[model samples]
Target: MLFTQAVRQFLEHLQAVDRSKETVKGYKAELGYFNHYLSVKHNGPVYLEDIQLEDMEAYMQHLKERKKSTATRNRVVYVLRSFYGYAVKRELCKKNHAELLEPVAIIQKERDFITEEELEILISHIHQPVIRTVIQTMFYTGGRITEMKNLKIKDVDLENEVIHIIEGKGKKNRDIPIGKTLHPILTNYFENIRDHENIETDYFFAIPKSGSISANYVNRLLKEAVDELGWNKHITAHVLRHSFGTNLLDKGASLVSIQKLLGHANLTVTSRYLHQDKDKLAEAVNLL
Candidate 1:
């Protein structure tokens, strides 16, 4: 079967299995990019069976030539692995060269997350109720902006103090605890803003007539707050999430609790946020 056609089948399977919309869209775009590169490299469409290790190596080199970041190149290669795995399952390909491709190490920099005090400052500065609540939710819940965008009114449990994250990253469902600060912020938003808007849609957050609140808009809102506070950092919704884990770690919360709170599949991923604090480094040096 044609390689591009196989990609379509794989993406459809992702949708059928109820993968997150961003995952489906991102994987589709990445695969499409690879398909274009492979077609150009081979001077035409290459069949699934025609794929070889050399082709995979050349594609990696092509990504480097294009000045793609290590993380971006890794994602493209990972998508290729998923694609070929699907092809192999359907008997369209004999082997998965994408998996056999050498690993590319990503040098992930530590993201600057807001301090608890800064979060309070940010919330205090955001006069807009919807936007304030959105920041509060990210700080309190550690949810991705996409997860917040996908949230429905029904997902919030006010009485129980839980936010049900239905199908977060890795297709995992988790319930994050509602913080004392966020509970009041959310209550006010619902009572004053969200209810007054009378939006017919089930989505918890949206602009009037614009449908759901977009990730781009949320980023802009954060950028404004960061600028107003004179914070010399690029903080996004995910950075707020990083803050959530780091804050908890600072407060003597166990890594196991944080792993569960962030819905990380393993402890290693959760451990990344623990060592960035200067206090933690100082304490470690004194142990000698």
Candidate 2:
């Protein structure tokens, strides 16, 4: 089949499999690039059987020349692999050219996290109750922004002082301890802001004035707070998660516990947050 036809079939399969909108968009972009390359290099639409390893290599070079990040290149390559694998499964292609393709190595860079003092400063400056509660939730639970946004009132166990994360990364569920430090604030925020009549809706952070708060609004509020404080670090909701893990590690929390709390499928993913506290590392090394 023609390359464009194959791409259309692949996107249909992705939709059937319930892929996220963002994933669908990435697949579309990557496949579009592949189709464009085939058209430009071969002067017409190349059939699936005409794909070669050299074409894959040239595409990698094209991505590099365009200054795409290693992660972006890796994702595009992955999308290509998935598309070709599907094509082969359906007998549309004789072989998958992307099967042996290797993604570009992504360098591990240390992530930036806010210190306890900096977090305190940011919280002090945030006067809005809803926003403050959202920030506090991230600080205490180490939950992802999506998790926080999707939180349901039923997930919170006030009597037990824990928040149950029903849907997290990799579809794993876990309960996170809610500290007493944030309990009263959360309780008050819920009482003041939550609509008791609409208790059936699962969203925990919904505004009564609107349907639900978008993740973009959360990021905008965070950016506004960051800009007002004139902090040099690039702050995001994930940074709060990083800060939580760093603070716990600084206080001698174990890697295994951190992994479970963060709902990470792998211990290695949780380890990235462990070494973010340079001052604590220096102090420990000096003491040793």
lDDT of each: 0.84, 0.82
Give the lowest summed-lDDT range of ten residues in model 1: 191-200
Candidate 1 residue 104 C-alpha distance from true site, Å:
0.9
Cα-based TM-score, every candidate:
0.91, 0.83
Candidate 2: worst-modelled 10 consecutive residues by lDDT: 206-215
List model 1 lDDT by residue over 1-288, tens digit each.
Answer: 788888888989999988878899999999888788889988999787887889888988988998989988888878888888888888878888888887689777877887878888887766666767888899888888888998998999888989999988988899998888889878877777885455778888866666578888878888887889888998888888899898888888999999999999899989975547776889979999
- The digit string of per-residue lDDT tens for model 2 on 1-288 reads 788988898898888877755577778988898789889999987988888989998989988999989998898788888988999899998888898888899898888787778878888877766777888889888988878877888888877899999747555689998888878878887787677686556678776666456667777788888899898878888889888898888788998999889888788888865556567668879996
User: Which candidate gets the maximum TM-score versus the true structure?
Assistant: 1
Q: How many clashes in each candidate?
A: 0, 0
Error of 2 at 115 (Å): 2.3
Q: Give the clashing pairs for model 2.
A: none
